[model samples]
Target chain A: MRNPLTEAFGIEYPIFAFSHCRDVVAAVTNAGGMGVLGALAFSPEELEQELTWIDEHVGGRPYGVDVVMPVKTLDRDAGIDDVSDIGAQLRSHISQDHWDYTDRILTEHGVDVAARDDGLEEGAGLGAGVLGWTAATGAPQIDIALSHDIALLASALGPPPKAAIDQAHEQGVKVAALIGRVEQAQRDVALGVDIIIAQGYEAGGHTGEVASMVLVPDVVDAVDVPVLAAGGIGGGRQMAAAMALGAAGVWTGSIWLTVAENGSSPVVTEKLLGATSTDTVRSRAYTGKPARQLRTAWTDAWEAPDSPGTLPMPLQFILNSYASQKMGATPPRELVGMPVGQIVSRMDQVRSTKQVVVDMVQEYVDVTERLTADLEG
Target chain B: MRNPLTEAFGIEYPIFAFSHCRDVVAAVTNAGGMGVLGALAFSPEELEQELTWIDEHVGGRPYGVDVVMPVKTLDRDAGIDDVSDIGAQLRSHISQDHWDYTDRILTEHGVDVAARDDGLEEGAGLGAGVLGWTAATGAPQIDIALSHDIALLASALGPPPKAAIDQAHEQGVKVAALIGRVEQAQRDVALGVDIIIAQGYEAGGHTGEVASMVLVPDVVDAVDVPVLAAGGIGGGRQMAAAMALGAAGVWTGSIWLTVAENGSSPVVTEKLLGATSTDTVRSRAYTGKPARQLRTAWTDAWEAPDSPGTLPMPLQFILNSYASQKMGATPPRELVGMPVGQIVSRMDQVRSTKQVVVDMVQEYVDVTERLTADLEG
Candidate 1:
């Protein structure tokens, strides 16, 4: 708890709660731990309003905003100025065979997205925005984040953009990036990132094959920066494990998804509540990247041998975004999932986010006391 | 610290050090933590001698014996009653194509094994004992183990046989089994295993895909029995994490390989000291089963395309065991390597087994003190 994360962020504890809901973020900060809001699905205007609301509610307590800016992306074209422009590029690149494959799976599940959408990109189920992959989209989001009195700016996909890093540093906001490998962590430190969030394969969303037990200490040894261990970190024992591996704190996302005030769909929450740690699989169907999600019929179909290969980045997001949300479908779970760590199975209850944070801190103290007794004896 | 592991074993600390060397086991027990001697490399007679040595030196300090009694193995013939019978089955089932492939790799690397031993089934580099894969071999080792006044009988690969568990309990010795998944832990508990070793993928030799952070808690939640955390556990912080995840103690193996009085070759120890966490790969090249080992040319060749696929256990082991040892080569590292965990990177120096135990306890105290100070503040 006396590590770099608590000291740098000026927080009582280093338990990081990652969620998209503004309420959860404000609540976690109001408690001892820090809250990080995921901004992938947010428009600049929407994100601004959300941050504005969070600032007012947090009572000057620190919170962070996470943006997905992958270093390797499909929208590399400098001319792409907007999400629509990226969508146009995406529509042009995805082949008919891929569409047929996605459509066949959706229709078989009873969604029939191709027929329902009427050739428009508009879909009812998808929340909002697409392709946070490019800097064109992520830059404006960073501008909005810097405008707010945020304590930290987190990049999910890869190293944060140089411009984003400079802007955050200039605004006195610490910059952090999540990495799955030791090489990426060294690169992040070389690029002057303030913190490295070392995520393991058991984590939700995009991840690498290395587990946190190995990756946390590996990243910690390879670089001089502080490391926040992510993936499969849900409770006090996991937070203690992170610190044992030389990590400054724990960066958790999946555990927050089941919290009472979470912004995720009820379908996801229900699936998660009944799930075990082994129920999650790393599937590329949700987005172009290989992200860990619940093993639904959707994930099984996309992984089947006869299915079409996934499109890269924005193209996949653009082609299957509507279907992914299963907008207006009678059954919500036909295509509803999000990135979550292997810790999903332990999330069987709907506790308040504040309770989750409080329990973790208290459990950490209790566990340490138990361990220290043996050490002293 | 004050959990089932200590209560069941009467050890001051719940740390369990797993090693093939009896000296290291004796040292660990003398240092307050429990030591477990791995019996995979010993014949019945050799094992008896080793156990006798441990008993004489331990000053009545309790210790455990670990025998690899996998539930399913390549040698499945119930009528086959001996190691030579299994060896005959192994020799017949192996294709010459495999022998030629193994020989070719060795010869090309300047390690011609045929001329040195004149077709004898022995080599200098691979320590000792050919097969620990089946009950045919492991039962005899267990018989030797039970003859000694051991405190515990631990099984690896799968659930311990009912006969073994019942006999151990009848003899007033506890039975423990190592598991990598929640289902395995439940099955072990149902079978009345005295303790569960929840080993993550970060462990050496045989392992499952789940990490310690996720697997430990999942297993802890599933079973009411005592649990020991293994894999990527070389120090105190990891011990605290295991306790947090509800494990009674930490079970470690790889860290002992580099200890001053270890049984492994100095060549392997030097390689381990110089290696990083990513330097290991889970390959069936050495043992038929996928055990993590130093990433060498032998492992790479077996894992690569355009090569003959690895043979099944006992069969593949009987055919190529001699060649893999690399009896004598100038470069030394032509094919020599040993089983190790991803925690190899942290073993930057070689210390006494007693010093490691002392340091771990000290570091555990330091970490908890730091965490508790913040919790109270």
Candidate 2:
């Protein structure tokens, strides 16, 4: 029960649940572990409102905010000029064939392409494809996040920039970076990150090549800081395995996406619940980054020979954001597949976030007991 | 074009070609990678003769012999008689209900019950019962192998005993152990192993719980010495991935069984070629240890609800050895399956070990070039 990670975070359990839903975040932190609201799906103004809601609902529980600032992106040098120039550059990169395929698939699935499109400019809708890493451009969002009492600032795609680390540390907030390899862990350590999240490829969203079983220990060994194991970890048995491999705590994302408080459309939750371990694939169809997502007709279409490959990073996200927003509202059966990992297979039913955390901890204790018996026997 | 692994071993590639047949061993060694003859199925004297034949044919090319010298076994405390007693114990453990189900299934498949009760023990006709990790008591066998000038000693289950490591080191031969986790790699290092073989669960034969993509880098980071990546490495792209993840070399086992020079029966080779990655499963039906093998009716029957759970270690192996030997000699379509890893899906053709090795190196080059180009671009 003495979790070093929870101690470090001033929480009850080391569990840090990453979810887009504010209710799930509040529920987890209130139960014990820290709840981290995923800010990737929200605009700066929207995220401020969500943080305000969490602050009101969490009742003084320490919580964190997660951002999608990546160290590398497609067209890293593409400067943010006036809005029109940025919008024009992004549009030029989207191929006609890719748009046609997206249109065809969404239309075939009974989604209204014209209504969703609305001749929007770049970075349209509730969630725009903003490159998380460019600190000068993203600094305002970070400033807005720091204005609230967010306990942790996390960069999902790579090590948070030195400025972000310094800014968070200056504000007395913990800085965390997600890494998939040992070299990245070493770099994060050198960059003075307070926490290293060893996110395996089995995790949802942009992940590196390593799996949790190997990556957790590799990161633990590579850095002196506490490591949180992420990816394909939904149960206590997996949490025990990660701890045994050297992780101080478990950082879970996909498991929360199916929780009762999760706002992921029932259609996406149904896909996650009904899926098996093999139903997920690491593809660049969503964000032009290798993200583990539910394997569906959309992914299959992207993989087809007739289709042009996915565009790079923010551009690809821009192309798909409209369909994702539409799907979220309309809940298409075939065209919608949410980002999730292989842990989706084990999610046979929905439960309260509190129950998920409690069951995982209980399972972890049982697994350790069994392993102890094996070793002693 | 220069393979550092091959250069280190002074062979064509870092490839340690493992085979049960002496002729194939000789051929692989003569072609470059050291042909390591699987000595588990051979008696000490028989193995001596097999090594003698390989020595004569290899023309002084450095070759080795592989023994199933598990660090622990079912009858570790018991001698040969104790092994037999364990077999009797296993028979008692199998309930009549399970036996009746197996009988019914075999009978339904037109397999005779009388044949099932045939005078042969439960295993491949090679011998009755499982091959116990006799390597501890297998001094004579080790002595025989040493007499033939083997350059390396490898144990799949655990570190070869300190004496074995010392003896091999004394003879200027390297000691290698297969590990499935980072902790195991550290253990092997502390035990003074010269080479650490990080075999992922995707590998055939006895394996630990971790998959290769995660296991390799963890082992590499855990140990001080060079680590050879094994499991699911059947081609250049995979080899490249392994090296990119920080492997010194790649160790291939399943791919060799499908090689042209490998003496695996045509029926077995055809089954292997036809099988895909999903066609393999990790089951303890063949050996007490979890091994990935071709999914067959025999394995299915053993895993069914009516069947008793597998016996522990060597005892389970003893019950199945007679059937395995029979299947090995003339692989029946319904009952035969070979110890193979996930890479079996890629083993779609029979090529010479030399050709395979050459192709892997070429592919490694192409893959590295691509990764470097992507980064640079």
Residue A40 displacement in candidate 1 (angstroms): 1.2
Cα distance off (Å), candidate 2, residue A28: 1.1
User: Best candidate, DockQ-wise?
Assistant: 1
DockQ for the candidates, in order: 0.44, 0.03
Quote the positional error of residue B75 for candidate 1 in Å.
2.4
- The candidate maximizing TM-score is 1
> Could you give the TM-score of chain B for each candidate, in order?
0.94, 0.89
Best model number under lDDT: 1
CAPRI accuracy category, model 2: incorrect
In model 2, state the lDDT of residue B293.
90
RMSD of each: 3.7, 18.4
- In candidate 1, which residue ranges exceed 4 Å CA deviation? A1-10, A77-85, A88-117, A120-130, A218-225, A283-290, A297-336, B1-4, B77-83, B91-117, B120-130, B284-286, B305-311, B316-335
Report, in order, each candidate's fnat. Answer: 0.56, 0.01
- Residue-level lDDT of model 2, residues A95-174, one tens digit each, is 78877887887877887777755546544521444534333345556777888998988777776668878888998899
